[model samples]
Target: MSDFVARRPIWSLVILVAVALLLWLVFSVWTPGMEAAFGRKRVFLSALFNGITLGALYFLVASGFTLIFGLMRNVNLAHGSLYLFGGYLGYSIGELTGSWLVALLVAFVVVGLVGVLMQVFLFRWMEGQDLRQTLVTIGLSIIFADLLLWSYGGDTFQVTTPDWLSGPVTLPLAVALRSNGEAVLMTYPLVRIAILVGAIVLGVLMWLALNRTRVGMLVRAGVDDRDMLSATGVRVQLVFVMVFAFGAGLAGLAGVVGGTFQSLQPGEDTRILLSSLVVVIVGGMGSIPGAAVGALIVGLAEQFGSVYMPTYAVMLTFVIMVVVLAIRPQGLAARR
Candidate 1:
């Protein structure tokens, strides 16, 4: 399979081009139907913006998941729990202190501490035991969920954003109205744009860390061959523990960002976790760039699907996963 991919790399390029053309055709033919369904041509711009914002959030969450899995091969099912917990904690702190920035900082630190504790108390003992790791993390997730439900109740909550980020920003670009009226300028929540910018910055930083730093070299080496890394006298366990904590911190930060824009509820943990799983599977298990691409695809599919095929929107992600897997089981950027 690797040889085939290497020899005929253009095949992947061809597939991508075909997919783009198909999407263009579908959207072109269906634009009128969409405007009719939504009663506005602005829905196109709205959906596109929403998709990009949502994809940014997904990338933040999935990047952490991929990092942990790529380095330690640990399926941290409790990751979503950490996300919800972080949001709830942030909410509590923000309400108490009346400071969103404080809440965000505290949430990241607290969740990172929890991650470190979980690694020390639970995962460290079960090294190389995939089944045990999975079961334990699942159990922990259930426990965290129940605890959160009991304490926070099932009601949805949204974190308060800073004053500077509360309003919408109008874009310089505008779209023509379906009624042949004057073009309307699009506006989006400033917070959403912040999230997108944050994701991009985080992606670049992560890329640099992985490619330009010694720690990143160790991480990549560990992902490729843990036994060899350990044999080289690197403190593999310590490195993994730090990686897990960092990943968990990222998840916690994403939770707070997401909760600020969307509502946080009882099932968000599972939903985000599932979304992360889909992203990593489609993007390539450990590839940062792959995660970003997968997140964008999933985000766009979700937004467009909800508008055009509301009845089947939920199934769209699964369909994408299936299609991607059929074409490239190892994912879009799996290591060769």
Candidate 2:
């Protein structure tokens, strides 16, 4: 029991459960009259679901950011650019093919390839040169942002949820809740559920891939000591390139997934990137669980802030970030 308590993995699980419980308690108290006003319990439930969905999307982007930053020590100012470009590509592809799934896949692969090429052509050369790489990537971000603005004309574009997911799902608990002083509310958008499911699935897959797979082992080893791995005859450069590519691919996938729910414009990239950076910083660099925790907190804060305090919603994330950092500069789950 003591060994288990001391283990990071076990503590991580405990933290997750604690956070979930806290969220449940907070929402239940804050909206005690929700059922009376809305005539349904699903409204409050959906808000929690919505928070998870948003967190899932943030996890996708922030996971990538964490990985890249952890291994390469690159701040990756261009990450947001990749995200924007992915949305544009996915939108364009969907417009042509009229299939959202195909567009998502195409966007992931294309953006991933771009990441690999970027590493190969630019980052690889600047390895060990942190300042130069940061400046160069910042320049690249500006260039990409300007090009996207010029091409897309700053217009907001929407990605339609598939027909199958267009309607609501009457959750299993809808009818059961009526007996517990809760009102019946059955209809909930299926798309939102899908997003939540997808994000959870992705998070699990990422964890397994990182913990149980050979590639993941290489990644962990690389993060710990790239020089040692290279000295051991591992193709460290190739691994770095692949890691960067995978990270970028995850970001692109997020863009495509999130774009379905919210319209994308040229400016959204910056908005999301800033949020993602906050998530990364608050969560702790290179920690997947940290990213999830940070993202959920940020997401819920955004949701609640928007509903109850619209003006503070914008500043809410930064405020939390500052508090967290002040208390723990290494982040809430900082390993170092």
lDDT of all predictions:
0.88, 0.83
Provide the TM-score for each candidate, comma-separated.
Answer: 0.89, 0.88
Compared with the true structure, what per-residue lDDT tens digits does model 1 show for residues 13-114?
A: 797798897556434433557557755645766787899899999998999899988887888999999999989999999899999888888888899889
Off by over 4 Å in 1: 1-39, 177-182
On TM-score, the leading prediction is: 1
Poorest 10 consecutive residues by lDDT, candidate 2: 171-180
Q: What does candidate 2's lDDT look like per residue over 1-336, in tens digits?
A: 456456767676887899798566434433446556644444455666677788888988899999998899988888888888888888899989989899899989999998998899999998999899999889988998999899989788887677887987876444224446774545667887788788888889988998999989988888888899899988999889988999899888888887888778887888888989999989998888889889988887787677657788879889999999898999887678
Runs in model 2 with CA error above 4 Å?
1-43, 174-183
**Candidate 1: lDDT over CA atoms?**
0.88
**Any idea what lDDT model 2 has?**
0.83
